[model samples]
Target: MRYADRLAELDSCMLSDALDNLGLPGAVAGITPIWQGARMAGRAVTMRTVPFDGRRSTRHLGAAALERAVDGEIIVVEQVRPEGAPPAAATWGGLLARAAVHRGVGGVVVDGACRDVDEIRELRLPLSARAVVPFTARGRFVEAAVGEPVTIGGVTVEEGDFVLADGSGVVFIPAERVDEVLAVADRLAAKEAVMAVALEEGAQPSEVLGRTYEEMLHDR
Candidate 1:
């Protein structure tokens, strides 16, 4: 799951195709990059937030996750949403983005909403989430757990898993299948590279794209 540099070399579509070839579930749905040119990959460290009660929390929402994460690791937050809770609570914001950059975090993926889109963009932090809301989580949500499995885009994500987020979307790689998926994705990327060159060399669309693309997807 520590294949950040290698994973970043490929796009989400290539990775999704690789996952399909392996018959695995990793493509996260309903979430996307919060800014233009967003992309990052790293080991995951999760933090879950729940509805806040009157009781005070010893630490802030993302503090524990950041404290536990190392360089080239991403923070995954599960912001649970239910009725009667704050209607506009966001799981991430500007401060967290700054802290993440300072902590050397590769990026952040939230299951729920995020705020401070402009500030986060200014910091150039890689943030991918479901929505961009202007509400604060302070009075509505509190950190409930860390380093635990949480759902992101309906996909259960665990600590130490691989996370790849980009302009297309986010995809979580199972910790055990990182090498397998990477190998297939690399092969597909190489084939596509050759195809691109052929198309540039005046090869007809049908000639260059015979059946190799579909064959590769199924033949693995």
Candidate 2:
């Protein structure tokens, strides 16, 4: 099955555990879905932007990314800022959300702030971001590059990598490791299924789930 299809069947926490079992690092931290029950999986189209220089243009920060994205692709934006400083402005908003919806794009993942939360929610476009603010990017940031690797929440996401986001969090699966990761996740899901049934029968989670963590990692 296609990784995208398989990914749609799993959640972020399941994928995270699979990555951990395989010794891979792709769990993005401090980023949460903008709406409850929002979930998305797609190939990534990366964009890296920097705090706007006094004289540089800030036109079309997200427009370029939308144009470059194909159907079912996610735009991953990484805002460049000074160390230990907050983002100067929101890099995403309702306009971009509408464009993405029109283009059939899966969703957007922003490493910085995003505005127009109400509009984005109404549009029903899945969004995951670190923060939300009303500041505009017009004079605060500029697109530095597109189709380049970006670090979101300490996870390096490259163009074409598989991005899966849900209520738990967001995770990036390396393009080359998708098959292996999915295979492991499938097995883990099976084991967890057994535990789930046991739990419904009044079994203790600590005894059934916790005790099998390491055993399942090494099983099969």
Candidate 3:
């Protein structure tokens, strides 16, 4: 199966453990779905929005990324700020959600903040953002680059990287490491399933989650 197809079957926590087992750094920190039950997995199309430099342009924030990305891909927005500046402006909003929906993109992942939560929720476009605010990016931030490596949620996510974002959190997988990561995650998931079945059979909780569970990562 394709990477995106395979990743869609797994959640962030499983992918996190897989990364840990492989000594990789892809567990995104402080990023979660803005709405409950929202999940997305696809290749990453990265973009960066930095604090404005006292100038303005006709281009809209995140527009370039939307145009550059193909269907079923995720646009990752990395919000950069001036030194000692606060993350106040919103890089994503309702209009973008509507566009994403029409474009058939997987969803959006924002390293900073997003606005228009109500509209986005109504639109039902899955979005994962670090924060939410009413402030607009106008005159505060500008699109700096598209299709580049970006540091999002403290993780260095590159273009074309596999991304899985769900309730637990967002986890990015390097394009080169997807096979190994998927193999490890699949094993861990299988074991966890057995443990769940044992629990349902009235097995002792502690016994089901004992040293064996603790050392499952290194067992491979």
Candidate 4:
């Protein structure tokens, strides 16, 4: 599916609620909001390995591989493991961002560090990462592979999985569960909307919350 279409289907509210329920790491609520230009959309090109290793034979797929993805395919890189000594250098940089833009890649999601923050912001490519650093990752590691299953933010994102993200947050909907999750999200959104209306009408906060909780449980 087109990235925009997936994004539109999931919508910002659904994505936000999913992140809230999933507790993914980088679904940051308040931070330096970089990708405010437009909401990015894409299927996941998941990569779980982290901190580009200085190994030979790493596939520096570079621009060609990046551009090869269908429109709205966001490069999703997952770290090999959640913790340890952080990668010494940035996994991606301005060059990749520029290349991705040309290729119509939706955005980039790194479970590790990324460099070229200023440049990336200037380019206006959506990026979600653990942190930013000045160190570079050239001659260190190559693409090594692509289209493999990778995990990030406690979510096991598979290749070809649908990814929907915006300023609110990112959500990974396993292909098998997309329809189910969307149905649940729609119901939850409706309940939340009613609760919001009650709150605006001066209903007690606790009552509103309690009623909402009861409704969610009943729906289940």
Candidate 5:
């Protein structure tokens, strides 16, 4: 099945559980979607950026990754900074959001900050980030690399890895394990749907979900 189709069938929770069942780690922490219903699923186009030093060359932050990304690929950016230091600028913003939409990019996930959130919301692109800052990337940072592995919120994302993001959060699926993860996620989603129906029909949550949840997780 197409990645988008598979993503439509699962949410971050289901995929995260699937990853856990497979003993994999892909749940990103501290990154929240910018909009209430924002969601995306696509291959990753990873990039890394570092705090700017006056002597180093500056490229339009994220330009390389955006330019190279194919349709339906989400940009995953990792901000490189000194340990314990927070970023002083936005790594993503409105212009990039518009550009990504125009290019048919699925969305963007930043391990740092984003700005022009109002404009981004108007553009209606799915975005997840650590914080919001008003500063621009012009002199605050530079793109260090594109199409490479980048760590976002403690999760390692590589180019072409499956990226699924929604209100619950973002999760990455290793490119090689996409099929396996999807299979388990599908099963879990089906079981969860059954449980949801049972609850609506007056079954107690603990009785219908608690015991069955453990059994489903361990099954197969």
Candidate 6:
């Protein structure tokens, strides 16, 4: 199925709640900031590491490997930085972003940084990362590992885990929990849709959202 179609079927809010249930950290905040443009839906290509040191590098993915990527597979790179030290350099940049989009790669979810913010926003491909920088990985880093487990934001993602990111944030649905998580997310989305319709129909804010949402959503 198309990634956008799959995303269209699920509830973004429910997906957020499911991540909370899973105890994953980065899904809620800065690490997974959603890039505007195309929505991403795909299996993960996981990698594990810490701190994006410029000294560590991988051969830029060659054409053959790039061609291997399809609709729902993300380039999941990780950085394992020490408590006090920060990520070394921007792990992704404009060329990489364009290349990923060209290959029909679903998106990129980095445990570090990205560059060329305006250009990436224009490309409209899905990208989630820690921050943006003009300086990027050139001779510094290469693919440490592919199709291996990687940690991002505080989540351990195994290869082929179902990945989703949107306005709410990014979440990793372990292969084991995909069914249940999708189900709950669908329910939450359905209710939110109804609430949206009612609000448009002139329902008062308090009546549409009610005390539960007003209190619980804010408290969290």
**Highest lDDT among the candidates is held by which one?**
3
Estimate candidate 6's alpha-carbon lDDT, on a 0 to 1 scale.
0.65
Which 10 consecutive positions of candidate 2 have the poorest summed lDDT?
Answer: 211-220
Off by over 4 Å in 5: 56-58
Name the regions of candidate 3 deviating beyond 4 angstroms: 82-86
For model 5, how does the per-residue alpha-carbon lDDT over 104-220 read when each residue is reduced to its tens digit? Answer: 998999888899999999999999988888999888888888887888877788899999888888899998999999999988888888888999999987899687687676776
Candidate 4 local lDDT, 29-96, one digit each (tens): 32122446445565777554433465665354344447557676878775453266565666778988
Ten contiguous residues with the weakest lDDT in model 5: 51-60
Of candidate 1, the 10-residue stretch with the lowest lDDT total is 80-89
TM-score of each: 0.93, 0.94, 0.96, 0.78, 0.94, 0.76
Query: Considering lDDT, where higher is better, how would the candidates rank from best to worst?
Result: 3, 2, 1, 5, 6, 4
Off by over 4 Å in 1: 83-87
* Model 5 residue-pair collision total: 0
True lDDT of residue 83, candidate 3: 54
**In candidate 1, what are the lDDT values of residues 125-167, reduced to their tens digit?**
9999888899899888999899999987678899999999888
What TM-score number comes out for model 2?
0.94
Query: RMSD, model 1, all Cα superposed?
Result: 2.3
lDDT of candidate 5?
0.86
Q: After superposition, how far is residue 211 of candidate 6 from its true place, in Å?
A: 5.1
- Pairs clashing within candidate 2: 52-141
Clashes of each: 0, 1, 0, 5, 0, 12
Best by TM-score: 3
The candidate with the higher TM-score, 4 or 6, is 4
- lDDT for each of the candidates? 0.88, 0.89, 0.91, 0.64, 0.86, 0.65
Q: Please give the RMSD of candidate 6 to the true structure.
A: 4.2
Clashing residue pairs in candidate 5, if any? none
Off by over 4 Å in 2: none
